[model samples]
Target: MAKDMLNAVKDRLWQWLSSDPGFILNHCERILFMNEYREIERQSSALEKMQLLLKIIIEKGDDSCQSFVDILRIHQAHYWQLQQFFKPNTQGSSSPTVVADGGSVVTAREMENIRAKSINMKIETVSGAGGSQCGNSTGQNPQADYIATGGSVICADKICNTSTDGDFNLSVTVKASTQVCPGLVDETLPSSQEPAVKMIRQHKEKLVDCLRSDCSFILQRAQVKELVTDRQYQNLKDISQSEQTVIDLIDRLMSNGQKSCTLFIEVLKEPEVLRTYPQLKDISWC
Candidate 1:
């Protein structure tokens, strides 16, 4: 049974391993013993090194296939991206999950899901009032080593925390839902109900003047984020004054047909842009 499993696994994995020799050899060097790796490294070509790496893992037996997988995941090997072909996670009871010997094992895939869920949450600032998930406010900030004024709030794995440094300390309690609890929302805060682009175009005149000094700054950022193209960036740069730069940017966005003006509006709210243009804080939508 084991021999058949080994041959099947080897034949299936070989094509993926052999597809990129340098990639396989690079990862193998980290997994294989240094002395043994040096001999493999001395092999004339990447194909030879990969072949030998597979041979070494095969000789070590079935458990080593899982070890090989664990290491590939460790180095973030490219094979994992071909999930359609490499479905290790769906192996059921045949493949074992390895737990590292030491402290907690950190995986990027888990962290990515956590961050993805948190990004859509909008943490609007209010009067520094108490926001406890349990609905009990002591009317005083909690005794803590540090405090946060405000920035972003993250809700993950039933815990919510503010990445803040200014306002009174808040302690949000547990809930399995991926949203910021409705209690934290301040209903009275000024916000627009209209689509962001429509709201932006409605206030274009005011925004242009407000954004004058920051045109070059906003342009560089907008281009970097791909909201504006290379040609637009260069053309805007050649224009003499900050006011014209702002004007041309709006005109291009209006003509581009992507309704990308909202993206420009979003760029104004970015943390880096806010440092230069804090007035943008006034632009918010529901």
Candidate 2:
């Protein structure tokens, strides 16, 4: 039962990464070697890229996962979901968020065990006995670790707890009917959980895709709304690179806490600003 729940949490984590694969990848850069990162980046498939990323997190074990989460700065609401899986009274207390370094991060084995489940997580649709396995190349066993376990009492499909008596095996299968965690799509976060920051974080890739033409206006609004200090605004306004400027902007906003993020959301809502970034429209303050 515990393993299943753990895997469910892991599955949720992977699916959450899907929310902003590029952003997650960017944070991952902080932990990866240039060569290792290049290898994952070359995959060309976001799913596979995510797979490789999770694999590395697993290989890096507990500490690296902690670092990755800190580097990502996961939001409190999402962190609450993880709390469900890491109940304090349970033996799994150290499962993901361990008490260390004044903060918490996930365990790498969580990534490892969950990846093998192949719960699909909306990646592919497979029905019943028919499922696609990850491909291989050049006499290599790339799919070796992801093959679905046969004959084990454990069933990875529904993510339920089942005790089995047999040697352990591993595999992955992709299918449509696979049940993903509802938390990914449902669950209302508490009002204080910085929804604005979550929104900005989720869209950070788009905001930083280029030096947005609205960069100056955003700074103007930030200054007007008192969201950024004059010094901070001038520093960001001076940066020529759109990417770093936007990244810094987000970092600063999130650092300032919920009120700043709320004002930042307002900046994105201006008629002219929304004209440049339509997706950011209809947003309410966090």
Candidate 3:
């Protein structure tokens, strides 16, 4: 029957997607702590392991597996960016760590979704559930809109489309702090050096924490529908070079301003850049 064939096709799609190679690599990366590799050789080995696992996963040709592969590939690309730090051939001014602008910086919701998918990806590899299997949260809500007719279907787990019906809760938090500038010998008392380095370290930690928290809150408050307003979506879909540059420039300026905000006494006392950039709340580059 047509309905039976459609169901079979969908099951095949889900199986392939669930075992996505990229998704599997992410799981391996986390489980093996490949992220901790300090040398190029070690890192290369890690990459090799990842590649092998991915190849095997892809060959399986299941929908869920393919989905896993796609997710893993994305995470692996991120790992590749980190590998530059380990390249042995690169010389001069080498440090133990490399710092970049850091990506969109995932929101808590996104973070949870990634984490949930990661666990599920790993379980899929072991279970070999083949047809379809659901474990861990994917941050998708079962309550999400669905269409159905008069029919009854169930899985061995006694659940229908359980994998698609999940929800994630990401709460927001904020904190405030103040500290004297570090490395400063009070102009009035040149002998005062006790607070310099200590204050600087404290400030740096506080600044990073504050920025992370604010960014998370902003992302949570953002509404995708509002941001992708139909008109804007069309324009964004076909953005011009000039438009892209303007967007990039604005983002850099925004980050720069926030980075320096810690230098401002009042801003440091109670940081609030997110309040101004509410659009950042729900938008993700991916």
Model 1, global lDDT: 0.51
TM-score of every model? 0.31, 0.31, 0.15
Candidate with more favorable, higher TM-score: 2 or 3? 2
Question: What are the runs in model 3 whose C-alpha is more than 4 Å off?
Answer: 1-44, 73-286
Give the distance in Å from residue 160's predicted Cα in candidate 2 to where it truly belongs: 66
lDDT of 3 by residue, 118-198 (tens): 122111111112122122222322221111111111111112222323443322222222322233224322111223322
TM accuracy, model 1: 0.31
lDDT per residue for candidate 2 within 125-203, as digits (tens), equals: 2332222322111122111111222111112232434333443344433443443333323343322245776777666
Ranking by lDDT: 1, 2, 3
Compared with the true structure, all predictions reach lDDT values of: 0.51, 0.51, 0.29
In the range 1-286, model 1's lDDT, one tens digit per residue, is 4434546666545555554444455445334664464456455444565667778877777666666666655644355323322334433343233221111121211222122222332223332333432222223233211112222123222224433333432344322333343454553221122255456667777768877976888889878877665755776787788986786666545433223656776777779888888777776644
Off by over 4 Å in 2: 1-193, 278-286
Clashes (N, CA, C under 3 Å) per candidate: 7, 8, 35
Displacement of residue 126 (Cα, Å) in model 3 is: 47
